[model samples]
Target: MICFMKNNLIVSIQLPLLILFFCSCSLLNADEGKEFISIFDGKTLKGWRKAPKTSYEPWSVNDGVIRGEGKENRLVYLVYSEDENLKNFELKFRYKMVTKGNTGVEVRTRIDKTGKRPFEGYHADLGHVGIGPGVLGAWDFHFGSGTRKEFPCQRGTRLVIDSEGNGKHSPIKDAINITEIKKRDWNDCCIVAKGNFFQLWINDKLSSEFTDHISEGRLESGFIGLQLHDKGMVVKFKDLFLKKL
Candidate 1:
């Protein structure tokens, strides 16, 4: 009888400890993602600027959103001019391809104060998937001398850029779900960068992944920019948030 009572007591004690252990694990998992801070005020372009030597006519803020238009049929950039030069971070924003041509987010980018192109760095490419190919859901590389390497990792693909700046790519099935994205409507976009690894998510689905080992061209830290590419493109962005990883 005494042994039975002791066994019951032990079971009761062990049960609570197990429950506590599980609860702690749950809390840790919940906190795994880093915290983000608002980078856009939604009312004004307070912390952003047009790339130097570029026209500001393409960008505006209205109704708590940033809008860009490719009225001139030329490349332009609205760059994040704040002090933070991010090396490893996650950027979250909502984008709407209003009258789509080509639009994208630029990260780890160096702004050209007086060059022909707006910046040099990696591009998280986006556009109306209806536009197709190079313009739609891809990763792009830019150089300072008005050169572009388009679609290193197109939608539903993975890419690796070797030390010699050569890219090897492979398709990733279901990485981008076209049916899940709303056309002519707002969509959630996320770009995560850690070391040389990068990921692009559209509507919460992984769209592309890239690993950069291009010692000659890869950038470790730089500004962020929103791109307005080619003619007749209209894009809107809001809820710009950044989480340093």
Candidate 2:
């Protein structure tokens, strides 16, 4: 009887330890739903480096948000603090469109020495209508490159959308429509990536889920980037968050 009780006590002690260990791991991986680990310091671009500007201009920040206004040529940017990749992770932030040109988030991309651009692995697209969540016809360069044509990103969708296309979104659906997107107002953006499965959301609305065919090379890890096209419009970003899965 004594041996039985002792064995039970031992199990009780070890079981709690095991439970605690697993709980810690779970808490570590809980992405978007948990408190965000700040990527931007909100004061300065301390850990960020600007990409090469085509016109030798600079991107400025306002009231804790960073922005780029292109009056010259297109400027591409990729910033990183350490040598790490952002593969299969959830990223959430708030962005506002002032004047539309060409803007989208780039992920799993490598920065080029030219500083003028970065190669895209995958992108959560916004910049069109009839896209974002599950509206249908979501596309990307990797998957629907030559196959899915009719649907493409057209200026107006403000909804966050999930898509694949060499990190540039295509065949948009459920994305925040440009009309619904408040001009000069702050809006929310969210993205989730797992293996080839990707999901995007804007302003808390489920945008879309996509499967990629090209596979952005399945980079072990890469820097996150914001892009601006030649048209020259103002795009503001703030409240950047990232979590590892």
lDDT of 2 by residue, 108-205 (tens): 66644333234534555544232332222122321222333222432322222234533344444445444555456776666666666566565555
* True-structure lDDT of candidate 1: 0.75
Tens-digit lDDT string for candidate 1 (119-233): 6778898888586645566787776663434435777889987776678988877676777777999887778788898888877577888888866556788989899887778
Clashes of each: 0, 30
Per-residue error for 164 in candidate 2, Å, reads 16
- Per-model TM-score, in order, reads 0.79, 0.62
Residue pairs clashing in model 1 are none
Over all chains combined, what TM-score does candidate 1 have?
Answer: 0.79
